[model samples]
Target: MARFLLIHGSAHGAWCYRELIPALTALGHQATAIDLPSHGDDPTPYQEATLSGYADRIVSELQAIGEEVILLGHSMGGYPISLAAERLPERVKHLVYLCAYVPKPGFSLNDRRREAEEQPLMEAIQLTEDGLGWTVGDDDLNRLFYHDCPPGTVDLAKAHLTIQAREPSTVSIETTARYAAIPRSYIRCINDGTIPPSYQVTMSEDWPSERVFSMDCGHSPFFADPTGLAGRLDQIARDIT
Candidate 1:
């Protein structure tokens, strides 16, 4: 069985994966999630959260595990996971992008988002006055992230979402062959409202078809379809081993 380290996206913490972790554990795999910096219960101030710091946190977790594990990233989490893998390739067995961004050389996550043809999330973003962080507007929260999620998802998210640091997304990353050599897979959410499904296709276009999978759900599959997501992950784990 593969051990998995799941990373949440912007403004979200490990709490977001509440359902998926147990689902994966039930399938005979070990899964763990962590709050990245200022998100969730972590006390790091938003202004101090940087992409490298996020990667460092992930690296520390991997070291604590003391074994190779599959590193999975959701949405903006792609950036940090990629950096972690690059920093400690031996600690990572595989990289999985779940409706997540796949970083490009010299391009920050924000730069990539800007390059997208459709900006579904633009209107939903509420930037902080200090220009250091941003939060999702309540009115667009369900529509953009939890449209197909379970009934109580929005309420749970509303109670837990935190201000996402902007520096992490704005700073560009440069990955080397160490990162490129690791096996990777991408899961595209077909009904995604936050990140367009078509753009997901474009992002993973060069990847082998076998490494790419699809889910007929929105962005928050952890809430929308945990079992289905688990099944997909199980299959990926088996394939990897």
Candidate 2:
């Protein structure tokens, strides 16, 4: 059995992995989903967080687990999880990017964001009145985030959605060749409006593992096809092991 650290995307917390955690546990693998500082239960306020803060939180939790783990990052969670794997290579068995960002050394998340040509969406996002670096809008959420999600689930997600910190998105990560040396995989959601398939292919090209797995769902496959997503994750663990 492998230990798995499941990191969630921006505007989401450990709450996003509710279905995934139990599924992984039932398969005999230990799993933990964390709420990045200020996003979930940490309660530090969304505007106050930075990429380093997120990465630090992941590393701290992994240390507490005291076991080697398969590191899984979704969306924005990819940034920190990638950095954590770079920081603690020994404890990471495999690095999985679930429709997540894959950055090069010294590349910030915003660099990839602009490269993905998502400036229109970014511009449409409305930040808090105090000028905090976070923004959200219903149209943006439905179109980019939960396009394929059930209406009811989408409503629930929107109701609970929090503004994402602009800092993490703007901060460029400083990575060594450490992560490239590790085993890596990408799970791409074919219908992901939030993250384009073309972009996924572009990002996957940088990795030695040319195998970019496909999912016939939207961006949030965890909600769209939890069973299938869990099954795919299990397969990856076996394949890497």
Candidate 3:
């Protein structure tokens, strides 16, 4: 069975993967998720959260796992997972980008978002007064993230979502051959409202045809179709192995 490490996106924590974790386990693979600094129950202040801090937490978890794992990053999670793999390539068997940003050398996630042809998510973001963090607007959250999700998903998200530190998205990252050598895959959410499906295609256009998969759901597949997402991940595990 393949072991999986799942990382969440902006303002979200491990709680977002509640459905998918058990679904994957039922499929005979091991899956674990963690709260990045300042997210979920993490006590770190949003002002203190940084991209490197996120990467460090992921690295520590990988070291504790003590074995190779398939690292999956959802949305803004791609940056940290990429950095973690760069730091401990030996512990990562593959990197999976799930409707997530794939970092370009020297470019921050914010830079990539700005580069996208369409700025669909811009309307939903509410910047804090200090300019250090952002939160999703209440009205836009359901429309952008959970339009296709189950009944309780939006409520769960509303209760747990926290301020997303802007620093992490503003900092650029550098990767070397160590990170490039790892197997990589991308799962595009075809109906994603936050990150346009067309942009997802643009991001993964250069990847091998076999490495790019698509889901017919919006941004939050964990709640929309957790079992299907787990099955797709299982297929990815098999394909890579």
Clashes of 3: 0
Instruction: Please provide TM-scores, in order, for all candidate models, with all chains considered together.
Output: 0.99, 0.92, 0.99
Candidate 1 structure quality by residue, lDDT tens digits, 101-168: 99998999998888788999988889999989999889999899999988889999999999999999
Off-target runs (Cα >4 Å) in candidate 1 are: none
The per-prediction CA RMSD against the true structure, in angstroms, equals 0.6, 1.8, 0.7
CA lDDT for candidate 1 = 0.95
Greater lDDT among 2 and 3 belongs to 3
* lDDT (C-alpha, whole model) for all candidates: 0.95, 0.81, 0.94
- Where does candidate 2 clash, by residue pair? 108-172
lDDT of 2 by residue, 11-124 (tens): 888888888888888888888888888876778887788888898898898899888888999988889998888888777888899999887667787788767744435656
CA error at residue 13 for candidate 1, angstroms: 0.3
Model 3 regions lying over 4 Å from their true place: none
- Cα lDDT tens digits, model 3, 141-217, are 88999999988878888999999999999989999999999999999999999988898999999999999999999
Quick one: ranking by lDDT, best first?
1, 3, 2
TM-score of 1: 0.99
